[model samples]
Target: MTIGQWYNEAHRALRTASTAMGRSRALAAADINAAVIARSAIYTQLARATALLVGGSPAAEAPDRARATAILARHGQSLTQLYVGLQAAAVVERQFPASPATAVAGPARSLRRAVDAVGVIGDILASHVPPGQTPRTPEGLAVRAGGGVQSGLADIARLTSAAIMIDIALPGWLDQRRGHLTEIYRPAAEAARWTANSRLSAVARELIALGRGQPRLHGLDVARPPLNPAPPVSTADDAVAAVSAARTWMWQNPSELTSVHLQLGTQLGLAVHVLSSTGDPTMIGGWRQAAIAAADLRATSPVGPARDTAAELTEVLRWLRSIGKGNHGEPAGRHLQQVSRLNSELPIMAATLHKGLSAALQRRDLFVKDEGVLQRPAGSLVFRAAERWRPAMRDDDVVQDLVRALVQGQDADSRSEHRSPSSRAFPLPPRPRTPVSGAHWAGFDPPSGPAVRRSR
Candidate 1:
């Protein structure tokens, strides 16, 4: 070939390679996105199925099963479409000489968008049923009328696995925002510590009682005047003595009444978390009453830190209630308002528990903003659960584990004490490459030449 012709051919080949690489990158991005979307659809279906099957099985059988099946069929169609799109993208990606460089940014964005969209869909599905029939109480009319319990749970397990897949990929996106969170958490933690300590102290003093049934003027040793002029007697000291007696009574007599302190503490803690996150203060009054009840238990006993703190906690809670009503300036900081409102809603049985927990979360929110080593180990547990569920496609044990992890993080002193999953066995059929679809569905794509595989 002539020199000029050879040079032209080289330039042509280079241009072709660049074009091919760009296409490869685009396809890879699409494949990642498609996989996420498919998984989301599957997760949604499985959740619906499980809810219907488990929650409704006892109430209604035939209609419920039929309804659950129908729902699954529609979801199956969406899954098929997602798989087809991903497979096509994957095939395209494999043909290019150099895989596209744009994949780094594109895949992350696609994955996030897909998962978020599924969340919206889940919300919509939830709405189609009724309110208050969430994971906590799934046996509502819709579930009972639509499917059997076994199938419902099976579906739930399926979708939960799918959602985890997306959530698993979220940490990288969150890492960029870690620095901005530090400034927000520090002040909050300081305020929480100050608040919890002050409350505990107040409780101790109120229950103190001293004078009741005292030995009548026991003969005093008159040998010498006490140095530093024995500290003046105070009502606070008297209150402490009285409360101590009450404490003695409870410890001595187990048969008289049930010791519900620990149980009450747990209830109070949950109430506080619910109230704080939801930003409502109406609940604190009940908690105030609970603190009083606790205080009342030791009304005739000597005062100690626990009693004093309990009293202090009540006073702090009262103050919080007042602030929630109008004591604070208009439009307090959002977090403060939330904390206040949560304090307001305290049930009568859980005041101390709520107070302690609210204080703890508040401290953590402010003091530990580094996305600490704790967060990683915790996240790793979640990731591992997700991984375990991927191939098995089982949702129940995985979802249970996820919830357990969340609870552990919130309640445990140290995240280092990781709890293993309660059940190691997953109950689900192996994943099928081509999910079955129904006639009414519109999104299914015929299988592509190359198969697409979802990442574990």
Candidate 2:
């Protein structure tokens, strides 16, 4: 079948699955199994369709591709919500098995069909690749081959991260939830674990094959060492701690913030490309809002490192907008190189931000009422700090100033004589004074400091 034909097939399958899911919602107690099955089908089809569309050929008609991409994104989000709902239902059902015997038959049949449909879609995409395609020049060949290797490595990293989340992180999180594990859910949970492990192993082998097939690109393989290590952050506390550590590191190593911003720009540019490809207005609007938020952060920031970081963020957002408008070539390639250089740090930083956001949302009490005001600015600061601490940019003055200000602010807030309206409005939380390289400060101070300024 042609790529367009396959897209039609995917569309039809997705529609059928979505209809089933919708009908399942109104199903009686005995048919809850059917509802779960329908939801699984919907999730599978949406995921498959979205994946295929993302990797779709550039030759496909723009309008059709755009429409399909929009559908996939819209359905993808809905199916994710449904999947979450299914998980919640599973918890409820585990305690009181509403027709346990009914679970295996209907769900098994529905899932089999869904899996077969996905396999067919994958096969079609895989077979549709043009044969005998080779780069015209050695440089072109290297670029093509090196991109494959980088993509393969990225896939491996993503898959490994997902596997870790499924195996270690998820179970740990589930343990925290009440009534998460019951005898009825054990079989399904075990099956999911087995399936995830099997898939991970298969994907890993494929990624290794992909990497091996690509010719060695000399410059690409030479990775610069990281300035500082980024430990994995799984929880809110861990994310907050990582942010703190990153802040201290950046303060001591201010020059590194520029490199951090460059890396961030690359990542954001890539995201813009992906979102633009989807042609979904809502998604594009959300991206624009993020850019606007960055701009606002830049406008409101003080004349120090915070403003500098915000300005860098705004510049990146503008670059990303340009990339979306098809103004990419050498500049995009340069951005990609920056990403490659900071490959080790980028994932950790992304993960930390994701976790931190999730933590903030889940525990509102941990953040102030207007947490949105601080989120981007604080994040920029942390990113700048982290990048500075990284070996690529080893300057620490920016981060040191941040630490000094934080420490001084806290101290000033403590002294009644020094309290001011501005400080009162945005009071620094009290923290124990600790010295950063003989300079006294509060909380997690960097290893060293320059001249300390007393807060009025």
Which lDDT values do the candidates have, in the order given? 0.28, 0.32
Across 1-456, the per-residue lDDT of candidate 1 in tens digits comes to 211232233233323322333343323434434433433343343333333333321222222222333433342233322222222211211121222335434443433343444344334334323333432111122233332222323222333333333333322222223454333233322322222222212211221122122211111001111122122222222222222222222222212222133223333334343334442232233233333332212112213433432343333334334434544465423434335222211221121222222222222211111111323354355422221111111122221222222222222311112111100011111111332111111221123221122233
Evaluated at residue 197, the lDDT of candidate 1 is: 27
lDDT of 2 by residue, 302-399 (tens): 24543444343444445444544544353433333222221222222322222222222222212111212223454365422221112111123322
Q: TM-score of the candidate numbered 1? A: 0.23
Once superposed on the true structure, which residue ranges of model 2 sit more than 4 Å away at CA? 1-271, 274-312, 322-352, 355-456
Worst 10 residues of 2 by lDDT: 385-394
lDDT for position 288 in model 2: 34
List per-candidate RMSD values in Å.
32.6, 25.2
lDDT score, candidate 1, position 363: 26
